[model samples]
Target: MTTLPTTIKRLVNHGPEDYRLETAALPQPGERELLVKIGACGICASDFHCYHGAPMFWGNETFPRYVKTPVVAGHEFYGEVVAAGPGAEEHFGVAPGDRAIAEQIVPCDKCRFCRSGQYWMCEKHDIYGFQAQDADGGMADYMLFKPTSRVHKIPQSLSLEECALIEPFACSVHAVNRASIEFNDVVVLAGAGTLGLGMVQAIRLKTPKKLIVIDTMPHRLALAKQLGADEVLNALDEDVVARVKAMTEGYGCDVYIEATGNPAAVNQGLQMVRKLGRFVEFSVFSRETSVDWSIIGDRKELDIRGAHLGPGCYETVIDLFHRGLMTAEGIVTHKFSLDNWQEAFKTFGTPEAVKVLLVPEAE
Candidate 1:
């Protein structure tokens, strides 16, 4: 076996706009743990929010504080297995040289949620890149998978770019599954970013009556249409709620999915979704979203669902990608070296960049 490097270049989130790139000691795998050489890691919107000190991640009155100080920042990642600890190869059914990805959440098996099979919402809540010790992220040259990690091997046929995208798309799959979309339901998806575009493709397979995607940017709206959305609405130029209602004969859409991190979209979704509609919210907001409760309880009586991370959907995503049901074509718009993280992070969610990546080394 080749000797591991002595140090690595990593990005650590110190707080809002305080991310510092530093050379850190390399992490070694323990029993049942695996060390991987990161191929690529995508800068997610939540990562950007975390950098800007979002209340949800930094914690506030409503949500408990999450980020432990000075943790490496990144989670949408995949890499090749370089070294495996005792029994890791047998346990994970993977060997050195195989590409693999781990679920974002590293569950505490002792938690009620974990024991009940809902590990995604584990009481411990250790998501990679935020929780310092157990889940250090992949914005570095290498990353380690803990014994408790839920890991899956990637197929060699998939490109390095697509392999890195599986995490976000898996998240997309989970959020779409939460909508309970019906064949005849008119579904409205807000946000044309990474997750939103993926949702467009996934929702198409469900074959909704009509899929209307909303975004403020024209480029993203175009991409959403290209990805299979029946129609695209520019929230910047259109009275989205009014337009969606008019299309549904004043009844509004039957299913509404919110992927835009903006708070205003939350209020708009409540208005555009018909009474008894299913509303699935999948954004990590930078600020608290204030919405009218009566619209949810007294007026509309909607089935509201919140999607967290990708859970029980990685394999389905792999299958989808393998079968060509999904593609990252128009989504991944930018790539930067590990040393150029600042620019890559700044490019995140930009009108021109749907998904920005940090490649450890060029393929």
Candidate 2:
């Protein structure tokens, strides 16, 4: 076993664009808890929004602020279990040396939502990296997995790059599952970002008649094609709704999934989906998105479903990774040491970057 250190470096978020790298005492495993040594942590779109002082992160109209400052800031990560407190192995079915990843939210298992098997919407709603009382996130050398955390053991053969992507991939799986696509359905995915690309791959498995990806960036559109998108449309260069309508015989796409955080995509999805089609929304927006409610109710009678964190989908994502159905190639575009987080954050959301990751340990 590697000798554990008494102190470790971690990124602490004080507020929007007010984070700093600081050394803190190493976390000790409490009862039914585990000490995990973080290997890699992926920067999410929500992380970028928080960094830029988006109203959603800072609090504004339509939604109350959720981020609690002075908390460590990373949720999509995987690591090795270094130590386990008593009963942790029996409770979490994990032990020292095992590779594991925890779901982003640590639900209050006693809540009504939890009792009803909807823990993702637990009334307490404590997600890592945002809530201080929940376990601190994995943007550090080490982090803690609380007893209430939803932990999953992952295969060691998977690369750290693949492991870091599991979180977002699970989310995409949930989004795809929510759509409940049929064999002959024509599906349209908006925005070929990390989550959008993952959705393309996951939705392809359902054997949709046509899987179309829309994005402003040609590079991302090319990647979407490689990932099993039957058709790729440059929303910037083409009238996406017209192109989709032309392909679908003017009926529009059978399903439209909005993965882009941009509010404009909401209207695009509303416009492109056929009447009575399913529209799944999977992004955490930075601000309020105003759209015509009639598009959902009277105009189309569309089944608009909201997808939150990856609930009941993590195991499926890991299994898909093991079966080689999902991959990280060309998706995880950049890596940086934890020391270069500032530069990494800047690179994220840029045209050149897809999934940016921070490696805690030097390779």
Candidate 3:
């Protein structure tokens, strides 16, 4: 039997910009539980937002003390199953030495939503890295998967970097499915960042009549083209609504999916999508987004949908990776050792970086 370490290093969030690299006792696995040795953890936009004291995470003056402090900070990660407590194999069918990943949210199986099969919106809403009621997070040398946590086995053929992308790729797949693209529909995807780029590839699999990508970053837009986007538009150089209208002969796109965290992209999608078109919003905004409601109700009659955490989509993403349909090229931009987490955050704040990952053992 492989002996487990007694303690491990982890990045713990104390408050806004108040994170510490500390050593703590390793979490012990219980019945039907799993201990994972983390390989890679991708930094998400919400992680950056939390680092900067966003009201959604840090809470505002009116409602302070939202996030659970001193919690480990990461949700997008993949690791090897180092230890499994009794009944783990019978419950989750996972064994030691297997590569595995769990969804970000851990449902309270007793909640009505969970019992009814809508567990993604469980009432408890305890997401890893943000709350400690369930599992902490994967931002450490090792972490635990709670009994109720949904776990999936990953193929060893995938690189650590590719495995780190499974979470966001699953989100992309959910967003694309939420869009409900038609065979001859013109689809517009806003923001060619990590999630948007992944959506570009996922949308291509639908074989839409046109897959248009919009982004201010030329490099990301170029990558969108390489990912099978039918047309790439530079939002900085042209009037996006006008250009999109011209392409659609003033009909606008049939479907619009917003992946950019910027609030302005929400209005842009409103302007570029046709009346009665479907719009999918997937970003985790740092602030309240105000837009014209009349556009949706009176003018467009749009079918607005919100895509949250990767619910019921992890398997499809893994299958996509297995078939070589999804590639990590141009999406995962940088890797940093856990010691250089500050530098990784700085790089991720810049527009140039697409996806930044932290590897515990990276040199």
lDDT (10s digit) by residue, model 1, range 30-61: 99999999999999988988888788887887
Q: How many collisions between residues are there in candidate 2?
A: 0
- lDDT for 201 in candidate 2 is 90
What is the lDDT, from 0 to 100, of the residue 245 in candidate 2? 98
TM-score of each: 0.97, 0.98, 0.98
Quality of model 3 by C-alpha lDDT: 0.91
Model 3 lDDT per residue over 257-330, tens place: 99998899999999999999999999988989999999999998999999998898999989888889999987
For 1-363, candidate 2 gives per-residue lDDT tens digits of: 689999998988899899899999999998999999998999999999988899877787767888887899999988999999989999999889899999999899999999999999999888888887475888899999989999999997788878999999999999999999999999999989988988989999999999999999989999999999989998889898999999999999999999998899999999999999999999988888999999899999999998998998899989989899999889999888889999999999899999999898754
Between 2 and 3, whose TM-score is larger?
2
Alpha-carbon lDDT of model 2: 0.91
Q: Rate the local accuracy (lDDT) of all candidates.
A: 0.90, 0.91, 0.91
Model 2 compared with the native: what TM-score?
0.98
Ranking by TM-score: 2, 3, 1
